[model samples]
Target: MEISAATMDDALHKALGKIIKSKKAISLDSTKGSNRELVGVQIRISDPRARFSRAISRSQLFSSLGELFWYWGGSNRLDQISYYVKNYRQESEDGLTVPSAYGPRLFALRGKNQIDGIVNLLREKPTTRRAVIQLYDAEDLDSALSPPCTCTLQFLMRQGKLNLFVSMRSNDILFGFPHDVFAFTMIQEIISRRTGVELGEYIHSVGSLHLYANQQSKAQNYLAEGYQEKVPMPAMPEEDPSAAMLVLVRYEREVRLNQTLPAFPCGLADYWLDLARLLAIYKCYKKKDRETIEKLKNKMSASVYEQAISKRAGQIKWQTIRQEPLNFTSQD
Candidate 1:
């Protein structure tokens, strides 16, 4: 099954519709319950920047950014990622780290940085087919839990655009698909900028594209929302975003550790500063510092993040209410 769409949201809706309609039930030894499956599925996204879903239920904007930073930092530590997606703790073996984390595989696999290698490879030879990043290694087979769902990624420079091809062993349509597209496409754009080429389409190929039985209702709700207006994320600066990314990572650690934020104008462009501000907002949300969150929110330059931040703020408020101690006095 092949599906092509302008954005990830459209592709997700289409794929879910197909799976729900089929009603073919199958169980996996690795995961519990039956799942609706589509074998040999391929999807192409024309505009990778429109990666975030517009659906309110699927407002995974915050988690997606956390995952991207996790991968970029080349870390598999559960403490860092579990905050964003608590379920990731289940994938970790000893509650410390995930063995199959793509960060290590992509960056330090056998002591080689694939990101740098790929960028340099494309610069040296635009037409080379060897620009591939291997994620699933032979040693991963020894692990009992959390083998990589993705297999390999190949880059092709065609017609002056950098197209990315991703091969996955399996992809969970509801939880995994959106995050994968966002992170991979972000990498694609980063490479495109570094190579001074136009960003191109993202092609994702999966051996099994599936929706678990437990998540069917959620999937249905997403489908019932109808078509979402496509909202593309702001473009990255034309220059290499490596420096900005480094600064973003530094602030991410600061926010995560609840440290005082460094002075602004860290010599970064506004595009990157906005991302740092987003992280600060996330920290404020965690601390229940609504006042500071409001302050940071007003400073964001991009309007695309407004909805997600609003949603998160609501959630935090609800959580605070749930945690507040209630005193019951009998007035009878």
Candidate 2:
């Protein structure tokens, strides 16, 4: 299923609302020191795209869905979730498995022909089955080298019904929490079709769902935008592994550019538009944080402008202008 930006925004809104309504604010321990918050929500939708993008982005530590799936997934990290949207086959052990908390485990299904393989697996084993992908590697976590995510998702098929259970250890309520729902649901949809099962409920169990004080105002603004009107899910594309690679290359370029010249003097909106165009051409993911981008752009531009003005003034006064414009009058 194709998940669009609007769909993601709606899912986030619903999740935030639930947390607020339940009056269950996440607790923060002073030891962590990271000013992050976590919020959780459960969504039931037929669309698979929404779920896929949400999961990968949250897991991969990227705010953009396209970037997460295309770039991070292509990097071959076993602890991260693997997606076979076009097929249902399990991944081969070969070189794909990585060392994790649960020993070396295959996080996602992998096969030569994903679609065909999944169909075959379902046909042969028509029982309640699960595809488990984990993010927290105990070794990595204990060594303090694990990524910021501590989440796992399980897709279960029982009696021709598909259900998703997401377990999160620490959620960034402001940014990361909402996207989780969308990602898992997408996985559930893909598994259901390959196995010919009906879509079921989504159960999200969050451990820490605090709202960061800094992001409180932004969260409120998002809430004011109101819930999105429900729409039909988009069509899923055929399985293409190359597409994932393309996503990674594009995202790498974006990260490099952003980090290298973060203070480039340019118009805020114009800069983002340029970046967006570059991403589209390279088939990378784009996000909807224009406000943040704009603010950064303006800061960059102001800094450049100040430097240029200072240099120009110095050049005119010290280098360009001499003591005086001497007039050699023919001895009048």
Clash tally, candidates in order: 0, 19
TM-score of each: 0.92, 0.50
Q: Which runs of model 2 end up more than 4 angstroms from their true locations? A: 1-11, 18-22, 26-63, 70-72, 76-123, 145-148, 159-161, 189-201, 237-332
Q: What is the alpha-carbon lDDT of model 1 when measured against the actual structure? A: 0.84
Clashing pairs in 1: none
Candidate 1: where are CA atoms >4 Å away? 23-30, 259-265, 318-332
Q: Write the per-residue lDDT of candidate 1 for residues 1-332, one digit (tens) a residue.
A: 78899999999998888877864535454464588788888999999999989898898887888888889999999998887889888889898998888888888999999999999999999998999999998988897886899999999999999999999999999999999999999999999999999999999999988888889789989999998888898999999988888777766776676555444545787788787777767766776766566666787889888887787677655353443221112110
TM-score of 1: 0.92
Best by lDDT: 1
> What lDDT tens digits, residue by residue, belong to model 2 across residues 253-320?
44434522222213223322333332322221222323233333344322312222222223333324
For each candidate, what is the lDDT? 0.84, 0.42
For residue 327, model 1's alpha carbon misses the true position, in angstroms, by: 30
